[model samples]
Target: MVAVLARFLVPLNSLLAAGGARVSAAAESGKARHPLHAMVAKELRLWVATPTYLMNTAVGPALALLAAVSAAVAGPQALASAANVPGVDHDALAGLVSAAFPWVLGLCVAMTPLSASSVSLEGSARWVAQTAPVPSAAIVRSKVAANLLVAVPASLVAGVIASLSLAGGPADAALMVAAPVSCGLLASCLGVLLDARRPRFDWASAYEPVKRSANVAICVGAGVAASFAGGGATLLAGPCAGIAASMAMAALSVLAWKAASRVSLQDR
Candidate 1:
């Protein structure tokens, strides 16, 4: 009976200590906002700086150039032939390119979440957040804003370059800018939620968001799907449909952020 009591008591003590730690951390967080805001900003800068460099300075423009060259060299007939083989109408090749813009937007969406929360989601860093003075919601909001800071412009620029270089339409360019902006906002919020809830702190694997993170896949997939759907609708009508679709996505994303903010602010 004495031995059994000792074993049970040890485990119970450990549990209580852990709970106390979490409670103390929560109390610390209610102390101030500036430090937390700074941390969030720092995380944002660290995350966005690298990707923004690679995408705006490297990949996005490169892809747009390739697409433009392909469109130019192959002309409509080549596109038409490819489309026919795929059973998707040749004219739709133009539509496909138009649709590709939104997918690029998705890439923008994926950046901040992948970068900002990767480190802090785990042990000590997580504790740091717990002790931050800012409301959890503000911290989350800062991260999302950081995503937009990079994504909105980067995606829009990608569209513009793709249009000018690839000979894409104005409408297509608009879709590119709008689609990614919405997707980026949504993805950023989701990333914070994931980080806070199921942090992959112990993960020992390489962190290639494009390859390893489920968030990346989801962000890109949603962006492409939205872009394509919007572009297809635009092809049937005019740019209005694509514009409307982009607007709708943005609206939904705002609602999502608001919902996420509420959750972040709730008592831990």
Candidate 2:
């Protein structure tokens, strides 16, 4: 439990501390606290400084280049064969992929275990944070923001590469990236909620959350849903669906955090 808590808490604390310090420096120098100021402050620093942020940003571009290289070396047919999924219009799919380069950026960031880390971070810092004047919602919001900051660039890079490589229309390409960033934000929020109830790192307790297939299914299902929605022929429905999904996820995350906050107080 201690180890589990440490792993979770240490990273979060470090992130918050670093972010807070930057914010503080700015505030001390001259800036006034803006609305959502604390959250924004934390987010900006983490985006530039965190490993997750860097990884998220890098993965999309790297993968896009690889996909492009593969397309170049193998040719369109080769690219189609590599895809292995039948019935897709090779050119259209390629176009879609190229246009959606930003999605890759989102993907890299979104793929991280945001949910898994939720409890560990909270558990580790619970004593201090709970005692502070800050609201639980504020803490939860900060986490969500931090993850979003990281995931946005990651998704953008990936989506752009995919979009540009495959010849996706500019609008389509933009959505490809935008949808993932929105979804990634939602996922990060959900993670916070999920963490609320997690038992302190007991292998048995941890396994249930870790091994659960529902999270994976939800993400995959979201993609499929987006695809179907896009096929509806409405101008923006598909992208809208992606955005809606992200909002839904974000809502869930908030609910989860609220619940967890209550639980924490009760336990105390």
* TM-score for candidate 2, residues paired by index: 0.55
**Residue 79 displacement (Å), model 1:** 5.7
Give one digit per residue, the lDDT tens place, for model 2 in 1-268: 2344345545766866876788779879998874455655544544434444333333433453454445445544555566667788886655444433334434444455344344443334456555756666666666656656555565565555555544335555556555556556545655555555443433333334334435433543454444344333223344445445445545654665566455452232
Top candidate, metric TM-score: 1
Over the stretch 1-268, how does candidate 1's per-residue lDDT look in tens digits? 2344344555655655675576568768885435545555555444433332223223432343344445556654565566565656666665555455455444434433442344333333466656666677776676566655655565555555545544456765566555555555555555555444434455443344324556444544555565556556656766567678667777766765676566542233
> In model 2, where do residues sit more than 4 Å from their true spots?
1-78, 84-107, 122-124, 199-268
Off by over 4 Å in 1: 1-37, 45-92, 99-122, 165-170, 205-225, 265-268
Residue 247 miss distance in model 2 (angstroms): 6.9
Q: Would you list the clashing residue pairs of candidate 1?
A: 32-133, 32-134, 33-133, 33-134, 68-166, 105-180
In lDDT terms, which candidate is top? 1
Error of 2 at 52 (Å): 10
